[model samples]
Target: MIKTNRIRMKAKPAGNLSRDDFSVEAITIPAPASGEVLIAARYFSLDPYLTGFMRGWQGPDPRWAEGIVVGRFVAQVIESQDQRFAPGDWVQGEGGWQDTEVISADKLQKLEPIPGVPFSVYLSVLGSSGLTAWAGVNGVLKVEAGDTFTVSSAAGMVGGIAGQIAKKIGARVVGIAGGAEKCAHVVNTLGFDACVDHHSQDLQGDLATAAGAPITAHYENVGAKTLDPVLANIADRGRIALCGLIAHYQDMNPIALKEFRRLLISGVTLRGFRLPDFAADFEQASAELKAMVISGDITLQETLSHGLESAAGAFLNMLEGKGTGKHLLVLEEK
Candidate 1:
């Protein structure tokens, strides 16, 4: 057995998370057992869904509080009992927030990476975040030419990609984002037709004017904060991919949107989705997003937090929607 140690963070969020809430400890990392691989984690994907588990939204879940928090990770295989994954292979999957993880073969997917693409992108654009955007834009909403596609949280990982995908497919894309800078990034960087700051006093008026025509499609991420204005301008029979309700999730609050009635009044179709719902489309979405990213059709945005210990703060920032793009932890470099 090749011996090694791992730094793992055990989180117990009493209220909102804090650095103190995360207690880092060092433990022995076991060598891979049969059909398992020992991995050295290089990057961690700090996403909002984790907050639910930490807060015990569903019930008492020890995975988040009493034990090492679980999340998607990119890692290098250091030892492998599985013939499919040899030493030095890079993989992505459900590895907890630790410096090294001993994951079963089934929990890991070998990455077929494009030349020059950073391994970190596998956790961001070319991974599940990109897939979520693809499913929301291409699968649920089916955005197409001449459509006014509006997406909330437009400067975010999924929302940015959704808008870019819509724009690429000839849709007039508009974004609803939190602040002025985020709104500008949604417009200038992601190439959306227009972007409205949700914090604005006249969000409804501004969004309607920016959209010009009735919104043919909406890819929602933020919940109540941006939903009402977007709903007010949605076209009759338009579609909505109810993606992440980050506002609700981060705050642990129930959704009560003013324009929810528009869903009924305008006869709009709203479909809430999880990745498992479109599992069959994962391969296609991953391929298309990778191609677009390589060809410069799709842009990648991310905030890198250095070190495994930084995971808690990064998770908090991501949940609070403080930064644009994917919030990631740099385990290898830090």
Candidate 2:
């Protein structure tokens, strides 16, 4: 028998989530059954979507309710009953908040070593975050060379990757971030043409100044306040890949777009996308992203918190925009 520590939702949040809403508890697991594997989780992915799950939002998977919070993780197979995996295989799966898990082998993807990239990349750039950005930039938006592309929350995991990918496609990339530090990183480190600090006194004017040309494509990560300025600057027939609405996640309310009419008059196309929509193409996208990382075509930043006990705090920190890059909960060393 093995004792595993896991974090579970003690109560649903009334408004902003606090660490008090979660509880870390230990549970015992017997040996795995046939075709099942016992995994020791090394890293847990902390994302904005999990915040919605805590607030009674029915996510894509209904299992993400008030019991054990659901999310992606990277783990090592310590014991296995299936031939596809062995005692020491690193894998990625839906292991949720547990430090140890007993799951069927079919649900896990065996992770191979990528030359020069860290194993944790599987939870970030090579995981769902990367796929979400790829689908939005390459699939939904279909950005082309010479296009002026803009991304909100450009310092975040999904938006950061989308902005870099757009730059690689020869588009003039403009980024919208919260503060001066984040904006500097987006412009200097991510190689965007310009970055607008949304917190600036004149948000609309700054966005317009940075984007001299009308934006041909907009990747929307933050809704509510952030959406209005981007909508005002979009070119006629421009496209938008609506990936996430982090702004409205805390308060369960519809984002009232001040410029909704502009979308119609400008003939702008707005399409909402989820990562699971491109499940069939994940393998191909992962390979391409791996190559991009190895060749320095892309870069990844992470804010890592240690142990299952710290998961709740890390999650809340991400929600409050307190971290750079991907927010992760590291359970153990690989």
Question: Which one is best on lDDT?
Answer: 2
**Candidate 1 lDDT, 230-307, residue by residue in tens:** 888889999999998888764655668898889899998999999778899988998898889999888878889988
Who wins the TM-score comparison?
2
For model 1, name the residue pairs that clash.
none
Candidate 2 similarity to native, TM-score: 0.95
Q: Poorest 10 consecutive residues of model 1 by lDDT?
A: 57-66
- lDDT scores of the candidates, listed in order: 0.83, 0.88
Off by over 4 Å in 2: 57-66
lDDT score for candidate 1 against the true structure: 0.83
Clashes of each: 0, 0
| lDDT, candidate 2, 151-213, per-residue tens | 999999999999999999999999999899999999888889999998988888898899898
